[model samples]
Target: MSFTVAIVGRPNVGKSTLFNRLVGKKLALVDDTPGVTRDRRPGDAKLIDLKFTIIDTAGLEEAGPETLEGRMRAQTEAAVDDADLTLFVVDAKFGLTPLDKTFGELLRRSGKPVVLVANKSEARGSDAGFYDAYTLGLGEPVPISAEHGQGMIDLRDAIVEALGEERAFPEADDEAETNIDVRDSDFAGDADEEAEPEYDETKPLRVAIIGRPNAGKSTLINRFLGEDRLLTGPEAGITRDSISVEWEWRDRTIKMFDTAGMRKKARVQEKLEKLSVADALRSIRFAETVVIVFDATIPFEKQDLQLVDLVLREGRAAVLAFNKWDLVEDTQAVLADLREKTERLLPQARGLRAVPISGQTGYGLDKLMQSIIDTDKVWNKRISTARLNRWLDGVQTQHPPPAVSGRRLKLKYMTQVKARPPAFMVSCTRPDALPESYIRYLINGLRADFDIPGVPIRMHFKAGENPFEGRKKKR
Candidate 1:
């Protein structure tokens, strides 16, 4: 079994920076702003040869049970409880505070092995603060600068000493640790006669939930998790970092991402909010399927439409989640209106799936999950070259490409270049003369004829014959 380490401390102590350093990726959002991380985020960490799971948690604070700060503190405490060892981090440049001492006593009572980490020790006056950490009675402070990558060897030695040499390095297992699953779904396809490989059951699907501020993005994810795994409240922008959580539904592994709520570009002026928005966009790019959450009370706001458009442009499979369904007294009427709006406003994502869900009460969650699964299958659907050419013949017969400069464009051949938001390339006599309207016509035909809906379809027109048609083997 792999050892688990949780970094806990007061706000702005470089816990996230240390986590990014150990993970060798910028997986967590780092800023000078305290309390940027409210939920406990986990990553696979390595130090030289030592490997373990590292959790980055919110800043420890004192607040009432109902306040947001109190909820953040609760998450931090839970991380400490679940960890095998705790890295009690402190700001060496700023020295120890009263809250640090209080949390130190708390960790001592828990009886978990604690490693005091004095962060930002590269600063000129950090020696006094590093020495002050010894007074907390945890242990000798391992002085290190998380930002500059200083004293990492000392940190590794301290961890190995805390966990004995044998416990630190366990036997390696041959089984692969699943991250993102890239297997094709079980959706029936007309592309090829040969059977595709079955879905990999062990791999996990990556789904990103995103929308405008106060759309209940976090609440919806928390409802799916059946716990407050994310920091959520009545606040409009409670989440600033895109946090990913691994889960299982009906024996299928899924990795769900809870992203920060986005707002209009003009309204997003703060540096921190911009960082959060960028992080959310990154999640969309990496996700296999994206769930666009909307406030059912005020569905299809301007920003909400912009978000859906962005998802379609990214060529990602998308589903609309109308959150706060419980607030609507007339469900039937509101759902009908929402469906009409989805069709009219989101023409780019034709035939998009929409589910009415109440994040607060867990209503319609099963249906939402089903919609996500179905949409993912559509996203990964593939079409064979022969089937595509046959479909192209029918589409042209129904509506030929418009004539430009009194000469009709002749589409010679068509083939799907790739799946996962199916992209196609067509070789035609006058590629430049083919109007944008004609391209849309062909894309629409592909969606309706091939059962590929709700995902972006890329169709490129190239002049002359297919590039690979006459290529000969050099070997």
Candidate 2:
């Protein structure tokens, strides 16, 4: 097993910054605001030759178990228990506070090996705070500036000392056994006229659950995991960072991302919320499939429609999950009404799959999962060049391209350029003269004919060159 390390500290002590520094990527959100990270996020980190799993946790705080802060503390404690080593971080620029000392004692009592990390040591007048760290009884502090890439060598040495060299750097035979099996077909083929790659079942399917605040996104993900893996409550915007969890569904590896709820732009006045929303958008961009959760009682709000449009524009497969089905008295009528609204308001994503589910009671989750799988297949669907040309012939015959400047436009050929949000390229005369209405008609025809619905389709037209003019005539 890989060695696991957890970064734990009170709020705003640069714990996230330290995590980003160690991982060499900005996986964790860092801001001046306190308590920005509520969920425990794990990433594969490599410090020079030492490779291990690192978890970034919320800043520890003292609060009642019922409050949000207390729940965040519980998450931090769970991370500490799960890790083999804990890096207790402190702000060296401003000495240790009483809360930090209390958590330091708690970490000591937990019996896990602790590595004291004094962040922001590059700043002037931080030596006193670094010296004060010794009073907490956590051993010598490793002074490092996480933001400026300073003292990482000392930090690596400290970690090796804490976990022992054997555990930090395992035998080569032990490390070689962890290689994942990836087939040649798993990678993309040639650049021009490339065949669609087969979906690698061995790889995990990335699905992101996103919606407005308090839309039961976390609850739905927790139900899928069959545990309280994500922090959930009645409060809105409880989750600040997009937390990803991996699990098996029907022997298939699946990774689910629970993102911070996005709100209207006008109401997002705080910089922290804006950062959270941007993170959520990044999740959508990276995800192969997005499950847009909605409150069953308040279905299809204005922001919800806008989010749907955004997802379609991003060229990702989407599924509408109407959560909280148990609250509805008239299930059939409400579902029918929801279907109608989805059709009327979101015509761009025609035939989008909508499933009603109750995150609390675990209703319709199976259907939702099945829908996700089906949408993913459609997103990766590819068509052959010959088949595309045949379909193009039939489509153009029925409804020919309209005339522009008294000359009829001719569509000579068409072929699929790529999939995963199916895109097509068409060769025709005067490509720019084709009206938007005709392009929409052809796109609709392709969607209906190919059975690729709801997912975004891209089509581009190019002017075809005359063969006779380019070469000498046979006569």
Candidate 3:
């Protein structure tokens, strides 16, 4: 098993910055604003030859149970509990604050292996703060600049030493331990007609649940886990960051993400809300399958439709679900209306899977889980070159391209470039001149012919180049 490290510290200590630096990607949003990271974001970090899973958590803060800061602290604590080691970061430029001492004491009580990190050490006079960090009693602070990428080697060594020999050499054991338990759902539903999914014990399927404010996204996740793992209340926008949990459904390993409830652009005035929306979008992009949850009573709002469109544009498979089903009096009417709206409003994602569920009562939770597994199957669907080309022939013959500038556009060849949205590349003359309508026609044809549904289809048109002419330079 890879070593798990959680970066924890007081607000604005550059923990997110350091996380972005270590992951070698802008996975987490970094800003001068304190308490920006509300959820625990996990990423695979690489330091030269060292590889391990790293979690970027919200800043440790003191607040009452009802306050937002208090909830953020709860999420961070959960990350610390799950981690094998913790990187206790402190702001070297600002020196140690009262809050830093509190966090240090908290980490001490936890008794987890910790590597003290003093961030912003590249600044002038920052050495004083680095020295002050020693008082925390964790160890000699590894001073480094998370923004400027300085002193990483020292930080790497510190982490390696903290991990020790057992974790560093994982290959020593013939079988790696998997924490996920394989169990079947209580409901007895037949698996989809598609080939039995090849379950990979190593990688968990990444699933994201997204919706507008107060849509019960967190509630749904909590219900699926059979516990109140995620904090939920009657308040809208309680969840401000994308928090993920390792889950198992029907013996399948799944990494489920409960994202911040997205409000319309006009309503998002505060800087924090905008950050939350961005975090939710990132969760959708990273997820293998996204479940667009909706409150059944008021489903299909403008924002909900927009979220569905965004997911399709991102080339991710989606499952539409209506939460609070127990509250709906006329269930049949609501379901029918939703089906009509789904077809009329979101034609791009035709044949989208929909499930009615009650997050509060746990009704239809099994169906929702089944849809997620099925949607993921379709999302990763791949068609062979031979089958793709054969279908392309029939599609072109059925609806030939219209003449452009008094010349017919010659379609030469077609092949799938990749899957996970199943991208295709078509080689033909005057590819740029092809109309959007024609592209959609080909996309829909490919979708229907391949029995691919509920997932986005990507088609790229390329102008066919003459092989002989390219071989010899034109004189």
Sorted by TM-score (best first), the order is: 2, 1, 3
Q: Could you tell me the lDDT of residue 438 within candidate 2?
A: 97
Native-vs-model 2 lDDT? 0.89
Better of 2 and 3 by TM-score: 2
What overall lDDT goes with each candidate model? 0.88, 0.89, 0.84
Model 1 clashing residue pairs (backbone) = 191-383, 191-384
Residue-level lDDT of model 3, residues 137-176, one tens digit each, is 8989998998999999999888889889768657634355
Judge candidate 2 at residue 23 and give its lDDT: 84
Query: TM-scores across all candidates?
Result: 0.93, 0.93, 0.74
lDDT of model 2 at position 121: 97
Model 2: weakest 10-residue lDDT segment is 181-190
Q: Name the candidate, 2 or 3, with the larger lDDT value.
A: 2
Best candidate per lDDT, number? 2
Report the C-alpha displacement of residue 429, candidate 3, in angstroms.
Answer: 12
In the range 336-362, model 1's lDDT, one tens digit per residue, is 999999999889979999999999999
